[model samples]
Target: MFERFSDDERAIEGLPVRLVIALVVGIASLSVMMNTIGGLTALGVTELDVKPQPEVVAEGSNEITVTVITPEGEPVANATVVAKDGTATLSQIRPAKTGPDGKATLSLSPSLGPNQAEGTITLDVKPPAGGGYTDDRENTKLLVVSGGAQSS
Candidate 1:
């Protein structure tokens, strides 16, 4: 009985079926893009940077400091700093928080592992939760020499 309503009547009341569907599809596409971008940002898609200077130092005599920052030169604070020789030497520095200058220091070990006394080590800096920064590690020639009395 309702087959009498013509397409003109439906168009007069609102948009045509195709136009309505297009509007809904456009809105849904926009929403999907926004959500995708938000998810990527939350996943820490950005890569951070870590620079260590004076890569070499005398064990138990000096400390190796690493500066953490973003590609845009922004300082990253409240992150975890870890140093390792890629073997058995590892140090989880305390007060790992980066200062206003985005610098964190870790002491070198004087006690070498087995027959080794001094070598290179890699630095890993991870941003604090919800800190809006990504994790980074040293992939360059960052090394420190350890040859002195072990410091407490």
Candidate 2:
């Protein structure tokens, strides 16, 4: 077979051109994938911002509104919001979920302690499944002043 083919042709067949082409393609694909991942990472994580509500409320159930969004201002839906008090005694908050608009309203009832009439409420907001987004939380103060005194 070597008699019919030139020496150069035989050397070329031994070079494994197909294998080299496949390796190059594989590397290119991997590079593209890595770049895509890096880009997504640079986009940063999600953020949760609790709207400004009354700092003081009566000794009853109060409603709080929170908004979840991305760094780019995109609404984050289906996020979980948890509220708790420092002493966990004078605050009753139910876990709420964000709607399509990234807004969740939580009902909080200020508990009156033996001698305490003011306390802080913490809101923990968690992103949806996947680690692509980071979780955020905030704290707000609530003072139990009088009955039906309106939130201030």
Candidate 3:
């Protein structure tokens, strides 16, 4: 076999590895400093300058029952209901779907006070994207979770 190329001075190459390392380290250090400054700024800063006032709801006692009604003023069957309050919060509050009368009643055991208790019950629906069904609770109003109530 051949004895290989003579003392190969042209076989080696230089890449300035120090420059590459310095560039990478400089980028990393800049990122870390930016993250630290951002974290410090967010520690005590509020997102909004003016805090909106919450709606004043009536005081409620233990075990507050809720009935979910659909957009057409009809009760939504098999709809999930959630009830939350200041002291304690409940999830999947009740099971019993709507009956033939399209009415589902959800009762919260040992409820909470009027300290801004808000509950959101969502239902899953198919999206137009042709994908699997998506959550459509935001678009539907099964149960009213806001200030004031409709007088029957």
Report every candidate's CA lDDT.
0.62, 0.65, 0.38
Question: Per-residue CA lDDT of candidate 1, range 3-34, in tens?
Answer: 66563365555557778999999999999999
Instruction: Give the 10-residue window scoring lowest on summed lDDT in candidate 3.
Output: 46-55
How much does candidate 3 score in TM-score?
0.28
| lDDT tens per residue, model 3, 1-152 | 44667755544444467678899999999999999898764343222111001222222322323344443354334444433333333433444443444443444332233654544333222222322222333433222233344211
The digit string of per-residue lDDT tens for model 2 on 1-152 reads: 45555554667775798889999999999999999998775365655454425656666777767666665667778888777665434445568888988888867776656666555566677778774666544533344554466765
Off by over 4 Å in 1: 1-44, 87-95, 110-118, 136-141, 146-152
- In model 2, the runs with Cα more than 4 Å from the true position are 1-43, 52-55, 70-74, 87-93, 136-148
In model 3, the clashing pairs are none
Clashes of each: 2, 2, 0
lDDT of 2: 0.65
Q: Best to worst by TM-score, what's the order? A: 2, 1, 3
- The weakest ten consecutive residues by lDDT in model 2 span 136-145
Better of 2 and 3 by TM-score: 2
Error of 1 at 96 (Å): 2.2
